[model samples]
Target chain A: DTAVSQTPKYLVTQMGNDKSIKCEQNLGHDTMYWYKQDSKKFLKIMFSYNNKELIINETVPNRFSPKSPDKAHLNLHINSLELGDSAVYFCASSLRTNTGELFFGEGSRLTVL
Target chain B: SQQGEEDPQALSIQEGENATMNCSYKTSINNLQWYRQNSGRGLVHLILIRSNEREKHSGRLRVTLDTSKKSSSLLITASRAADTASYFCAPFTNAGKSTFGDGTTLTVKP
Candidate 1:
């Protein structure tokens, strides 16, 4: 079974479009996060939810919003996507106790043309 | 700006050779971890070394941590072609938040 899974493996949309990516984890982890990997292979944490509570919110643009209905799921919604939003989004989860280790899902590639 | 910085942004080596990647962070960390990501895939956990620990080994991969310098290194011995991937170092704080550095892309040629 895939421990962590994210939908819309590939997304190709025009500029100013709205898109959402869903992520689910079966590992029963207490913390889930959304990460953006830029073209330079630099991974940055966008948001993190610990047991459905927002814990880490980086200085991401207001166009991106993250929702966590529960500890097992986290979703990202991009509003008015722009060309700069073209990147890979990865969903990851880790046990609250072992925060150093993370289980990541197959990334969702977003292409804004 | 506080994220870890990996050295030798890209590397290419023979299948049988060893590969090493270094990471330097700006502040003290609770632990340092390494991860690998293949083309178009998510990151995979490799190893984690605590600040108090100096070195750790998992299979053919060795990791060293120097808290004094806020630096860490990952060494993969006898690398195989299948080992070609991007390696990232993440130094985590006590708050369960870790920042990843720009990864080192390693290409192991057969």
Candidate 2:
């Protein structure tokens, strides 16, 4: 019974690869977010979607896209992934209330060689 | 180039000791949050302190916010070996955005 779940816990690919990571939240949260944790453990927000509507989109590369078919799911698609694209990606969801206490999914570790 | 920046980069402490990590931010925040991440894992939310509030506690986690200084601190009391993880501080602004810092790697020895 996980609140937030992500598929493909680990992914390994060579340069110029295309991959997708799927995430789902059963907590009925309205807002969902994507974060990338770099080698130094620096986690940064890449995108945020509220009820399938784009809310916050950081300056991530255009090749990195986040698609939310519905309020319950958000999937990330990376096209032509580069070496620098290797990182642990986390999917989180939270209600748009004051608490803003997020529920995060087990991250998907992406390795690009 | 995130808004929140954590100090000490790393911390080591003995079990049963209190561990503290500090974070400074460059912009005004609506709230500050602390999360713990096991090595190569996802981060779990620990505590959150709002701009109007100064401190908050959850289990062994204590979080303090100083909006005037644009900083926050997380205090873990009676830390155990299980508490060994990378601790991150995140600050959320009015723009519906939360930025995280390069977490402080914490190692608790038994």
Identify the leading candidate in terms of TM-score: 1
* Candidate 1 residue-wise lDDT, B1-110, digit = tens: 24888988999999999999999998778888999999989999999998899999999999999988889999999999999999999988877676788899999999
Weakest 10 consecutive residues of candidate 2 chain B by summed lDDT:
B1-10
lDDT of 2 by residue, B1-110 (tens): 33688888999999999999999998877788888888766788888788999988888888888888988898989999999998888888877687788889999999
DockQ agreement of candidate 1 with the native complex: 0.68
Pairs of residues at least 3 apart in sequence or in different chains that clash in candidate 1: none
The segments of candidate 1 whose C-alpha lies over 4 angstroms from its true place after superposition are: none
- Candidate 1 local lDDT, residue B83: 96
Interface RMSD of 1: 1.9
Model 2 spans > 4 angstroms off: A97-99
TM-score of each: 0.97, 0.95
Residue B28 of candidate 2: its Cα lDDT?
77
Docking class of 1: medium
Best by DockQ: 1
Report lDDT per candidate.
0.92, 0.88
Candidate 2 chain A lowest-lDDT run of ten: A95-104
